[model samples]
Target: MHFQFDDRLNSFRQEVRDFVAANLPAHIVNRQRHKSFAPDDLHTAEWQAILHKNGWSVPGWPLEYGGTGWSPLQQFVFNDECAAADAPVFPWGPRDMVGPIIYTFGSDYLKETFLPMIREGRHYWCQGFSEPGSGSDLASLRTTAVRQGDSYIVNGQKIWTSGAAVAKWGFFLVKTDTSGKPQQGISFLIIDMSTPGISVRPIQQMDGDDHLCEVFLDNVAVPVEHLVGEEGKGWTYAKDLLDHERTGSSYIFWNKRELAKAREIASSETIDGIAVIDSEPFRSRLARIEAQLTALEWSVLRMLADEQTPWHPSALASCLKVRGAQLQQSITDLQMQAMGRKSLRFIAPQQMADFPVSTLWPDYLVGKTSVALITRAATIYGGTLQIQRTIIAKMAFGV
Candidate 1:
């Protein structure tokens, strides 16, 4: 398989880099560079608007749907350059996860109503799949949507919903029927977050951020027209979304950027007057991580190129998720090690602007500790490492 970028791709990469350099805001870049958490809703919307103005907002969608019509390779290059430039990670629920499903399977009315808002950044979306007891076992979700003529009354709770507090809309999986199997009774529904009886409460994290939320729906009424595809077909739609999400779980771009930061820290931070990176053991660990990252990147590229693979798509995605989650934790652990005691300083997100800066503790150290603390969940979320291993085993061995 060809690993090198051709002349056209190289040119495209430079073009993206130049655009980001010219137009990406300095303040946003600063926050993204030092902060491990995603940008707030305002910044996310603003960045999406900027990309929309440049006609680069949704590069992976069909050309007719405000997409750039770029090839998969081009999309990869765009994402890599944006991540390298410290671009705010756009909210995936709208742009990546649910948007494609809407365009691909939704009614023409649904498309007309939501697609434009999504592209223009006029609305933000959150996924409402995980319930109180149903996360990895998504088909067992207990949320119910009872049809009531023109609308459906949705009643249940969704936990670990990212950005629900600020999201304008949510795509939820609810049981429209229960007589059939757990997976067969589900239906996909789009609900307005501001709808009465819908309450969102943020769940505080060790990192001191409340990006994750619990959404409680108490007899929330959602228009019947908001349903995506057909009833009893939500499981099918959800699988499509989950596949996209699992592929992204590899977190290649984030890994590359954080690994570079780890290297920078190792170079500057000292151990008995010698740079941490200069030590043999630490250097070896860093080299190993870099090599693993290279392999991960190649695996993602192979998937993008649609190369033949012996493993099923599900198994392949599980393998990538397992390794990618491992690398995230390892890289962050190395960063914490390099920072040593300075990593102990805990600065809350709200205090970042007013906190006094020290020459001994530079701005680069702002989010190091927090990131390391939160990355502990890397393997747990997006399906646990154990679960991924089971999937791989089942697919590979039929056991």
Candidate 2:
């Protein structure tokens, strides 16, 4: 767990930086800078295609499955550098979440059908886990899937489904048998978004974007083959998928990049004729956040290096998620503070083109307000702050 830099790692980092600088389209980067959640579908696909061509699309997966066969440290460096370079955040549902579940537990037919599309950026995917009342208590999901010979007829609703509007497919959690325990009866099923009985309705957000959506399925027939692994074992696969990218729950790369942006804003922004960074109050706040960020990064690196911890792996992941969600809010808060009055000038996504660009309203300040607004839900989504703390208490301390 030593924090020393290795020459090999440093060189690898430089290599990734060079690749992104040479290959990443400037227009996409510009659009990404203004986006608070994720890049638009076109830019995301274009960027993913470029990465796939260079064999860097899925760096953490196994070599045979179109991965780079990179060690955990190498994967960490790759993500860190990419975030710093403002690479479009590729859809994680396809590459990180469902892709792994399919490859690891899915049948050969499933792998042949989905993995190539995911790696090549030919399809976009979304998770259908959280429903109206089941956001945090995922085990209580009531979506039902009844077997009908070769297919399962699914009928339910999923809320807060990110990117569902643009997604071509979705992996959902459904109750296959209510006779057993809620957790025991749950099953995982992949459904085509274009299915006859499926509908996606975008939910308007305070940020003026419809990145989140409500998905409804009425008698949506999903192929039996689409069920991942075995029946009534979906709860297990879902947990594995959640824990697959454990360190990602920390959001270290994103926090680091946003922190750097916060510093840039502070250096340029003025508070009563003094640069924000020069103010004692602002400097102290920035320093404290930097220290916390450093500690968080070290903790993630220790986990990547397989350093043992007293807590269970699930509890550790929950701990990281709690801290990372806080930092997301804090870093954005600092940016909003740095912008001061400028942050108050709200610009909807549709008005960006019409919005005038001037010294008073620079590109950097364009999405700061919107991003800050959306980040308020960081602690609520994935898992609520209260739920994560309860998890840590139950699993880590056995309270």
lDDT of each prediction vs. the true structure? 0.88, 0.89
Cα lDDT of model 2 overall? 0.89
Q: What TM-score would every model get versus the actual structure?
A: 0.97, 0.98
Q: How does residue 121 of candidate 1 score in lDDT? A: 85
List model 2 lDDT by residue over 1-399, tens digit each.
Answer: 458759999999999999999999998888877766744778888998999999999888899999998899999999998889998766678888999999999999999999999998887788999999998789999999999999999999999999899888999999999997889999999999999999999999998889899999999999999999999999999999878758888889989999999999988999899999999988899999999999999989888888877889989899899999999999999998888788888888876644666887777777778888988998987788899999999999999
lDDT string for model 1 (1-399, tens) is 559889999999999999999999998887665565744677677888999999999888898999998988899999999988888877788888888999999999999999999998887788888888898788899999999999999989999988898888999999999998899999999999999999999999999888899999999999999999999999999889867775587989989988998998898899889999999989999999999999999999988888887888888889899999999899999998898888888888777755566778777778888888888888987788988899999997787
Give me the displacement of residue 330 in model 2, in angstroms.
Answer: 0.4
Candidate 2: misplaced stretches above 4 Å? none
**Candidate 1: which pairs clash?**
none
Please give the lDDT score at residue 154 for candidate 1: 93
lDDT score of residue 88 within candidate 1: 82
